[model samples]
Target: MPRPRFWGEALRDDESGSAALEFIVGGVVLLVPIVYLIVTLGMIQSHALGVEAASRHVARAVSSAEGAEDADARAAAVLDSIVREYDLDADTLDVDVSCVGDSTACPAAGETLRVTVAASVPLPLVPPVLGLQDATRIGVESSSVQKVSRYWRDG
Candidate 1:
């Protein structure tokens, strides 16, 4: 013989599939932010790598160039190509080149050339409205140094 439950008692005790439902709801609530965090970190990391590569390559190009003009051209070309390849926002890109030597002029022969590339990476899915895009940006910068040839020439 089985005992029959009243409607109120049955409803109160009825938790058969509730675990799965609660699990689903709890998972969704926990997962959304985790996914967003992963996406944000991924974007920042990619931009950081891009900036680092840009600085390293630019320094190498400038150091290996034949002359001042050649160095400028090479640096510009490398920076531009990296920007495009990395999908970095050109408007946010800034490059600084300096020489570590007594010479006032940059890219002096036998000097170490330093190149810095910096950019602001916006968080993924940030809206453009109300300046949120600009407000939520993360700044990434990288610098690289390369020594010019001691016999390097200036034209």
Candidate 2:
């Protein structure tokens, strides 16, 4: 049999596998979430990029609309395209277009138009069931502005 050890020797002997165990447990508890956070943030950023593009396109579309009557319809169509392209839920996405400087009619000539796109992206590695109340969904929003052509006239 091995010689009996002092208290310090017993303590050192018990620690042989503890480091590896702690490393594994700590890695699972911490490293996994860190990785998931990075991936989820990346996904959220990508969705934000899509929203920004959609906002820019919608602003351009509204700024170029020939008449106020057709502008809303055209803007709706563009928003629909964004929803389809981004695979966003209709209920979770909202778009707003407005004109600056006291212009009631959006896209008024020589005015600046702004488009805001807000959307929710499901968190990466999260279960859909966990997002039932949208707690696991991240909101991504973007706004874009475009100036109407001074020489243009609304029909």
Candidate 3:
């Protein structure tokens, strides 16, 4: 009889639901920003990878080409392809291609090709926290350099 009374009193004193509620609130508070940050970082990283790929594409084209004019066109085409493939707006990307250490009016050997791609990546869900109406913009810049191939010397 005494044990039963003690068990009933313990059950009445227990506050199990309180812990569940606290856990729920805490989980929500901690999980939301963590998820947002992860998504934002993923988006930024994806943009960075795209920029790097574009830079490498242009640099390789320039290194293998006989002149800057053709290389420039190839670079533009590569960039456009990347933008379309990644579903990124063309206006958001800024691409620049140039030859390094070229003193002549035309593309030359012993020179390096440089390509830089910059873009603004949108954050996933941070705008509401900052009281802004638009998504947060993150800037990504990638550059690549390629040494002129020896075969270009004959051209």
Candidate 4:
């Protein structure tokens, strides 16, 4: 027969399985949140890339355009196409255009044109609302600049 042990002896014994069990439990406690964080960051990063690409395309489109009306039309089309391609929320996007000589005025030939796009990437877990007017969200923005043709004159 085995000798009887004291109250604390079982817990302190050289057990092979208990340590492994504890390690697994502790690892699970520590790893789950880390995994979730990684997933969230990856999702946000994809959306950020989409916004950056969209901004660059819009800037290039606007820079090559002739007049303010043409630029606006090109920008609208480019933004819509990009948003569809990236599967991003169109309502959450904000656009800003800046010209070298006059910030608000149309970009003349050879002028530096800048386009900025800002979007909110929704979190993994959040309450969905009918409209995002008041909802707090993660903000991501990208800016792109392009120079218009120096020699070509718009008629």
TM-score of each: 0.88, 0.71, 0.74, 0.77
Top model by TM-score, which number? Answer: 1
Clashes of each: 0, 0, 0, 0
Q: After superposition, how far is residue 15 of candidate 3 from its true place, in Å?
A: 1.6
Q: For every candidate structure, what is the RMSD over all alpha carbons to the true structure, in angstroms?
A: 2.6, 3.8, 4.6, 3.7
Question: How much lDDT does each candidate structure score?
Answer: 0.90, 0.79, 0.75, 0.83
Error of 2 at 32 (Å): 1.3
Runs off by more than 4 Å, candidate 4: 1-4, 14-24, 128-136, 150-155
Worst lDDT window (10 residues) for model 2? 124-133
Predicted candidate 4 versus true structure: per-residue lDDT over 132-154, tens digit per residue: 53474689999998997554345
Which stretches in model 1 have alpha-carbon errors above 4 Å? 1-12
Encode model 3's per-residue lDDT on 1-155: one tens digit a residue.
55456777888888776888899999999999899889878878888888888888878887787665666677778878888776665778887766777456335677776778888887664456654524557788899988766556433
Q: Report the alpha-carbon TM-score of model 2 versus the true structure.
A: 0.71
Clashing pairs in 1: none
User: Which regions in candidate 3 have their CA more than 4 angstroms from the true location?
Assistant: 1-13, 126-135, 149-155
The TM-score obtained by model 1 is 0.88
Candidate 2 per-residue lDDT, tens place, 1-155, comes to 87978999778778566788898999899998889889877878778877987899888877777667666777789878877886677788788877767876656788998789998987765555744647867888999998976655666
Give the per-residue Cα lDDT of candidate 2 at 33: 81
Q: Which rank order by TM-score, best down to worst?
A: 1, 4, 3, 2
RMSD of 1: 2.6
